[model samples]
Target: MNLKNTMLKITTVVAVVISFIACEDDFATVGSSVIGEPGFNASLYDDAMISAHSYDLPAVQTNNLPLNLLGVYRDEVFGTQEASILSNLLLTSENPSFGTEPVVDSVVLAIPYFSREVLEDDEVVYALDSIYGSSPFKLSVYESNYFLNTFDPETNFEQAQRYYSNLEPQIMSNINPDVLYETESFEPSAEERTEYIVDGSGVTDTVTMAPALRLKLNNNFFQNKILDKAGTASLLNQSNFKNYFRGLYLKADEVSNGGTMMLLNLLHSDAGITIYYKTKVVDATDLDDDDDFEELIEVRRSYTLKFGGVRVNTFEQEVPQFEGENLFLKGGEGSMAVIELFSGPDANNDGISDELEFLRDNDWLINEANLEFFVNRDYTTGTNLNEAERLYLYDLNNNSILADYILENVGQPNSTSSAANRLHLQPLTRDENGNGVKYRIRVTNHIDELLNRDSTNVKLGLVVTQNVNLISTYRVLPSANPEVQRVPGGALLTPEGTVLYGPNAEDEDKRLKLKIYYTEPKN
Candidate 1:
C-alpha cells in the first residue's frame, strides 16, 4: 500500500484506540455488551516467532558528513577499524595580495576534538568526548591530487558526487610522494594549549585555546603553493585554488596493540591551516622622530586557509563474517542485524504467518509490545570498552522510523536529557558498576498496525546510533544486501558497538523475543 494511505489508516486507528483507552472505565462493559460477553481479561504473551541475522555492511558513502572519524579502533568482537580524512582547503578571501617580499615563516594545521569544559577542584579543565582507546597511533598527512567533485559528471551534473569509505586506496595512489607531516606516535590530549605570541615590538602575549590536534606542516609546501602564487590565477578564487592545490589526506596507522580513535570537528571556525609570514612595513614610530625618517621594518602577519569544499572520510575495517548465536552491531561500515517478526508457517498460502493469523483471528487489543535485547556481558565487559547508549529499530523495507518511535517522540521537549524518547527507544540499562544490562524497545504501535490495519509486516533493521533523534539515512554504496541500500546516518557517525542475544541464543531466557500484552473479551 502507498505510504500516505498507510499513514492515514494508522492515524485514524490510533485516534480510535486512544479514545477507547481514555474511557477505560466503561471499556469492559462496552466490549461485553457488543459481544454479549461478561468482561475482558488482559494477559501477557511472551512466545512469538522471531528470527534475526547479522549482515556485514559494505563500504558506505562518507562524504560531507557533519563530523569525521580519525585513527584506529580495535574491538574484541568486531575486529579493527581505521579511519582517515581528505579535505579541500579554501582561502578566506579571493584575489588576495601579499605585501612585497612576503616571506613564509611557519604553517600549522589545527582540528578540534569533541570536548567540553568542566571544573575540577575549582579549576577549569577540559574533558575530551567521543574519543576511544588510549594508546598512540601513527598519523601522516600528505598532499592529495585527487579532485573531489561537487557534482557527478556521470549524472549530467545533476546529482551530488558520492565518495565511499573504501576510497583510501584510490586517494593514497593520487597523493604526493613526499609526506607533508607524520608522527610516529600520536594521541589526543585534553589539556588546553597555551601559545606565546610576540608582536612587532617584541612584546610577548599569552593566548589559551581549546584542545585540538595541532601539527606543524611542511613550510616549503605552503610557501611555494600559497605565498608564491599570490594574485596569480591559482590563488584568484576558491575554485581555482582547489583545482591548483587539491587537498590534504590525513592517514592513520596502527603503531601499537591498541590505537586511539577520535571524532574530529573539522568544520569548526578555528579548524584550518594558518600561514605565518613576514612582510616589510613602514615603522610609524620612526616617522614621528625629529628627523622625520621613515624606516621599513619586518612585521609578522598571518593568513588562514579554512577547510572547506568537499571532505570525505575513508575507513578500512576488518569485520569477520557472522557465524555465532549472538548478533553483533557495529557502526561506520561495520555490521547490523536484520530482524524478522512472527516467522512461522503460512499454511493458507497467505502472506501473514499462521502465528500472526491466530492472534488476528482472536479479537485481541494490543496494549504494549516490547523487544528486549540482553547484552552478552562476557564479551562486552572491559574497563576500556565503550558500549552504545541506544539502539535504533526501523523498517528495513522502507528505510523509515517505526510507528512507535514517531508516536513517542511527538511533542517531546527539547532538553539535554539523554533519556528523551524513553518510551519507545530506551537507553541501555546499566548495573551498579556501570556495566551494560539490556535495551528494551517498545513497538506497540507498529505491532498494532500490523495486526489491526493493512500495514505490511516489514523486516526491521537494528543498529547502534550516536543519537536517537537523528533518523536520517545515508546510502550504502554497493550495499551488502539488495534490500538494504541505506542505513541510519547516526549509526555511521559512531564507532561503538555491542553484541546482543539473538533469536537463536543458547540461553533460552536471554534469547531475543517479542513480548506482547493484550486484552480479549471473555466468552
Candidate 2:
C-alpha cells in the first residue's frame, strides 16, 4: 500500500472511532463540515476552527484548615477578614523543672512574624512580602476555660474527633478577670539583631535576625495556671493538663480602615509562651565557707509551651460583590468561587453547546487549548491587598483535582492524543506593571476528551493556589500514592483575597474563554 492509501485507511478508522465516541445527536448531520473533505492543507487550519465561551457559576466550600493565625485584615475592595486562633498547649517535658521555692518572675508570649522573603545581600533591604499595613491593631489573649474534648464520649472512636472552624469559644469569663492579656498600642515589627562570631582572637562576622512580637503576658495567669501545677498530675501528663487547663484563644481587634494584619508563624520554635521563675540552688563557690553552704540565688529558668494539639484558625470575610452581578473568590473556607465552563445557549440545537458541538464533528486535531482569565483590576487594584498571584482550578464534583493537576504532579505530557489521560493547569504570570493581570491555563487534553470521548463535563472550581497544597510534592488524587494524600491540608494561614473577571462580565475578552488551536491532518 502507498502512503496516500495508508493515510486514507487511517482517516477511515478515525471516522469509525469518532462514530463510537460521539453521541447520536443532531450534530451527526454536520459531520462532513466537522473534519472537512479529504486532501486538506494543515496550514489553512488556524483559529477559524476554535470556538470559545464562558459562564458564571456559584461558589463552593473552602477547606480552611490553616496552620497559623490569619489575623485581622480589612480591604476596601475585598472587605473585611477577621481571624482568630484556638490551640491546645503542650509542655516541653513530662514533669517540668520548677525548682525549690519557685517564684514567678515574668511570663511572655512570643509570636514570630514572617515576610514573604529574606534578604541575603546586605544594605537594609525591605522585602515586604507578608504582613501588609503598619497601622496599630489590638490583640487580646484569653483562657479557654472549657474542656475541648478530642473524641465524643458516646462513641469511643477517632472519627468523631474533629473541631470545625465555626466552633464557639468556651472562654473563662466566669472567673473575675478572664482576659489573660490585652494590648491596644501594640506594634509588630521585624527586629534586626547584630550577632558577632568570636572564634580565636575577637569578633569575626556579624549576622542580622528577624524580630518577633514579644508581649509581656500577665504573670499572675501563668503563676496560677503553670507554676502552681508543678508536680501535680495535670503537669505530669499532657492529656491531663489539656483537660485541667483547656487552652488559649488569640483574638485580633478590628481597626477602622488603615490598620494592617500580620502573618504569624505559629509553628516556629521561637513562637510560644515562656514562664520565667527562680529556683534555689547550692552555691559551689561558697562551699569553702562552712556557714554559706546553700545560698538563696535568683536562678531564672523558663518552661516553654507550644501549640501541639488541634489548632483551628477561623475567618470572617465580607465580599460585597456577591450582592451584584460580580462573582466573589476568596481563600479559606470563608469564601470561594466556582466556574461552569462551556455552558450557555446551545446555538446549534444539537443538545450540546455551539463550541463543543462544532469541535465534536470537526476532524481537526487540537494543537493547544488555552483557558484565559482576566483580573478585575477596576476594583481589586484599588484595595490594599493585591490580586492573588495564582489560582487552582479543579473538578467541582470530587473536590480532589482535575486530570491536569494529577498529570502535572506525575510529570506527564499533555497533548491531544493524551487528552484521555491528562489535563494541565496553568502557571501564574505577572504583567509588565509587576502586578497579577491575567492567568492563561492549558487544558488541551481536557477539551479533547470533552469533544471526542465520553467524559462528564463537571464544573470547575477556582481558588487561591496556596489552599490547594502546601507540600508541592504531595498530590490530592486517589490515583496518587497513600503517602502523598496523607499530607493533609496545610491550612490558609494568610488573610488575602482576590477578585477576577467572571464569565458573566460585560467585557468579552476579559470573560473566561476556552481557546483552541487546531490543524487538519494531511490526506
Candidate 3:
C-alpha cells in the first residue's frame, strides 16, 4: 500500500532505518590502526559490487493507548451497561464474515501530545492530522460529547477520533516498544481506579533511534550576498561569499551565507549512530555464478531505518535569550518588551526550520522585542483601552506600522470597537525572573502568534521562544468576603513575597494569569 495509508505517514519498508539529524560535533579517535604502505598494490581484474535489498518492515502499534484518550475513553464509556464494548476496537479483526474470535496479535496508539478543542454546542474536537508536515496528524475538530448529559451516539471512535492504524501480522515483526501499544482499553474513574488506567501487564519496552538528517540547499541567485558568510557554528566566518562561488562546502554553511532560503538537516539527538542495511541477491544465479555476478540487488528486509531526531538546543542559565509570558489585556498604559529570534540553514534534512544556530553566532543577541502593553479594564469606556493600543504599535523601527498585527482577526476575542484597533503598549513592571525573561502575551495573543506567521514576528519570533514555555497558573484561593475581593486581578496571581520559576511569572505550560474584575471565560 501507499504511505498515506498508515499513521505518521512513515513507510514500513523491509528497508534499513532512516533518521533525520543535524550537523555534528567534534569526534575523538581512541585508537589508530597504522597501515604501513610498503609499496602494497591491490587491484581487481573486473571490479563490480551489486546488491539487492528488501525486508518486512515492522509496524507501530500503540504502546500505551494514550494518556489523554484513556481519559477520553473512560469518560466515553460512562453509564453504559456493557463497558466491555469500549474494548471492542482494541480487539483484533478476525474474519469479518465468519465471526471469528478477532483476537489481534496486538494493538497500539500514538502518545497523546495534543488536547481536544471544544467546539460549538459543546462538541469535543481534536486535530485529525498535522498543520505542519513534520508532525503526524492535523487539527481534528469534533463534537465534545459522545453522550453529553444523557445524549448517546452510536458507532463511537469513528466520530470520536481519527488516526492511522496497521494490522498485518507479518509486517509487525519487530515492534517499537516505545511506539507500540498493548492493544487494551478500560473504563471511567471510580473509587477502585483513580485514573482508570491499568498498568501494562508487559514490561516497559526500550526504543532504539538514530540521528542523522540528509541536507540539501540550492540557490545560485544572490550567491554573492551569502558569500559574505560561511561555515558551521564551529567554522564561524569561514564560508565567505568567495569560497561559496568555489563550492564544495557543507550545504548548511552555504545557506547561512546570508541569503533568503530554508534548509533542513538529519539531526541525531544521539551521536555516532549510523544506518546500516542487510542485503540479499534478488537473483539466485548471482550466488551460484562464483564469477563476476550478473544479477544482484540490495532489498530492504526491515523498514526500521536508523536516522535521528533533531538534537534539542541547549543554553546556559546566564545566556541572554528572550523568555515568554502570557498577556491578558484586562487595560492601562504599560510597556511591552520584544526580543529578536533567528533561523539558520538546517544541518538536518528533515526539512524543518532551525533557529538556535543563529543565536549562538550573533553573541546570543536575538531579534529586538519588549513586554510593555497598556492594560485597560474595559475597552467599552474611553481613553484607557486606546492608550494600551498606542504602545502595541510601538514604532521602535519607526516603520509606520500599525498595531494591527496585535489585534488582527486572531481566532479569539476579536475587538468590537474601532478604538480597539489602534491600541499600543509600553512596559510598566516586568517581573524579571533574573536570568532572562520578558513579556506578558495574552494567552489569546500567544496562541495566535503560534498559529500564523506570515505578517508579524509572533510566529517568526518563536524560533527563540521554542525553549520558552508558559508555566502553570493557579487562581490563588480567593476570599469570599467583599473586604477580601478588593485586590487587583493580576496581583492575586503572583503572591508578592514568593518567587516563581523559569523567568516568566508563570511556570511551564501555563502563564498570563488574569485576575478577573469582570466575567472570566469558562474553561
Candidate 4:
C-alpha cells in the first residue's frame, strides 16, 4: 500500500470523525470504538517532553487601542501598575462661533466607564464592569504642548506613529505648568447623574445618564483658549486647532493605602469636554407681536470638543522576576511564558527532538493533542487580584495563531463565553467557589502538522487575554525575544494576571504537559 495515499485517507477519516464528535459535544471522549474498524485501535500517550520558561515583556505599543485603562492597581505578586491617558482634542465643527459675548459657565470632562444596567426593586441601576480594586486614587489632567503626530516621520510618514506604554515621562515633560483639573481622592461611581435643562417656557426637565468619570475642568482656560479664538486662523480647521491646543494628559497617581483601576471607553459618543456658556440671541418672546422689535437676550448654549485623534494609553509596571518552577502570565506590558513541545535530547543533531522522532517513526495516526495548565492555587486563593478569564496561545516564530486555534474558532462568534471555542482554547475552569482550576487547550492540528506533515516545531507564546477571538498582534518595543516582535492585542487590553505550574514544578501531577491521543494499526 502507498504510504502517502494511506495517510491522506486516514487524515480525511480523522477529520470526519472529529467533526462528528464535536457536534455531539463530546470531543474529549474519542475512543477505539469510534473508528469502527477491527484492524485499527486507538490509544493514549501523554509522556511528551515539554519545556516552558517565563519572560518579562518590554513596554508595548499602546496608541490607538480599542480600550484604555486608567487608575492604579497593586498586585500582591506583580507589584504596582499605574495607567494614564494622553489624547488630542478634536473640533466639533469648523469655524465654530459661540455667538455674541460667549462667557464660559462650566467646562465638564466626561468619559463613560464600562458598565451594565440592571433592574433592582423595579428601578434601573448600573453595575460597573472591568473595574479593579475599590480604593481611591489621585487623578490629574494637564494641558499638554506635545504634538501627537498621525504618522512617523522616521518611516517617511508611511507607517502609523507607534507610541510605547512607557512614554509617560516624555509626555510629562511637555505639559504646561498649570494643571487643568485635579482630584486628590477620586473614585469611580456607579450612581447616575441628572442633568436639568430649562427650555424657553421656563420649565425644568431632567435627563439621567449612565455612570461615568465626570470632572469639572478649569473654565478660565477654556474661556481664553477656545471662546476667545472664534473665527480666527487657530480655529479655522481641525489641523490648525489641534496645533494651537495640543491636547490633555490625564494622569493617575497611587494613593497611600490602596488604588483603583478602571477600563474606560474614551471613544464613546458622550465622552468629551462640554463647555456650557451664555450666548447672546434674539429674544423671540415679543417678536410675534412686533416684527421690528428685536432684543438681544442671553441664552444657554453648549459645544463639545470630542476626545479623538491619536489617543494613547500609558502603562507603568513593575517587572516581576521569573523563576523556573512556575510560569507567570500578565497583560499590558507584563510577562508571558514560552512553551516547547517534544523538547528532549536529539542524538542525531538533526534539529528534531529524539522523542518527536520516535513518535514520527511509529506512524501513529494523531487524533488529539492538548496542553493542560493548572493554576497555582497557593498564590491566588485569597487574593483580591482579578484573574484573567482566558489565555491565548500562538506560534512565536510566525507571530500568528496556531492552526488548531484557527480551525476551532471558525464560524464562532467573537465573545467572552467560555464555551465559544471550548474544543480548542478552553476558558479558565473555575471551581464552585469561583477559583480557577485549570485550562485545557487543544493543539491537535498543530501536533499533526509537526508529527505527520514534516512541519517545524516552533516555540509557542502564551499570555493572559481579555478575549480569545482577538488574534491581531501589536508590536512590542525592545522585545525580549527576537522572534517575539509582537503580541496579541487582546492581551494588552486586559489588566489581569495568573500564575501556573510549569514543567519544572515540584508537583508532578499539576505540571504542564502535552498529552496526545493516537490511533494505530493492529499489527
Which has the better TM-score: candidate 1, or candidate 3? Answer: 1
The clash count of every prediction, one per candidate, is 0, 8, 130, 0
* lDDT of candidate 1 over 1-523, digit per residue (tens): 4522331122213234345456843121112223322475555567778989887888888888888899988877777789999999999989886666888888889987778999999999999998988888999999999999999999999999998889998998899988989998999999888655556453457789999999999998888889888879999988899999899999999876789999887889879998888876666676335554467666677788999899998988886866787888998889899999988768788898877776676666767678999998978987355799999998999999888775643233334244377768888998998989899998877887887775798999999988787677877886435867888877887889988999888999999978765667667
Off by over 4 Å in 3: 1-155, 162-302, 305-434, 437-523
TM-scores of all predicted structures: 0.87, 0.73, 0.18, 0.89
Cα displacement (Å) at residue 154, model 4:
1.2
Q: What would the per-residue lDDT of candidate 3 be over residues 384-444, giving only the tens digit for each residue? A: 1111112222222322222333443233233433333321222223234222122233222
The residue pairs found clashing in candidate 1 are none
Task: State which candidate has the highest lDDT.
Answer: 4
Alpha-carbon local distance difference test for all models? 0.81, 0.56, 0.19, 0.82
Specify the poorest-scoring 10-residue window by lDDT in model 3: 76-85
Better of 2 and 4 by TM-score: 4
Off by over 4 Å in 2: 1-66, 116-128, 152-155, 168-176, 193-209, 282-298, 319-325, 344-364, 408-432, 471-491
Give the TM-score comparing model 3 with the true structure, all chains together: 0.18
Q: Candidate 4: deviation at residue 510, Å?
A: 0.3
Q: Give lDDT tens digits, candidate 2, residues 1-523.
A: 3522331122233444345336532112212343444654222111212222222211111122445654567777666666677777888787685767777777777776665345657555435446756776777887776565666666765544545444433332422256878877555666543433323211246556566667778887788878877889988888888887777777776766655666666778777887766666565456345577567544556678886676656555564535543545554433445565556456557656554555566665654456777777777765676456556665655545556544432245335333122124444456787666776665656665676684677666555544344422212323322212222142244455566676656896677655554446564
Whole-model alpha-carbon lDDT for candidate 2: 0.56
Per-residue lDDT over 1-523 for candidate 4, one digit per residue giving the tens place of the 0 to 100 score: 5533432222324555556455654354423354637677665566677898887888888888877889988878788888999999999998998878889989989998888999999998999998888888999999999899999999999989999898898999999979989988999999988765546433447789999999999999999999999989999999998999999999999976568988888899989998888777666675335554477766777788999899888998988666667999888888899899988888799999877787787777666778999999988888876888888899998889888765653243333444366677788899999999898888877887898888999999999987787678888886545656888888888779999999878999999977776788877
Please report the TM-score between candidate 1 and the true structure: 0.87
C-alpha RMSD by candidate, in order? 6.7, 10.3, 32.9, 5.1
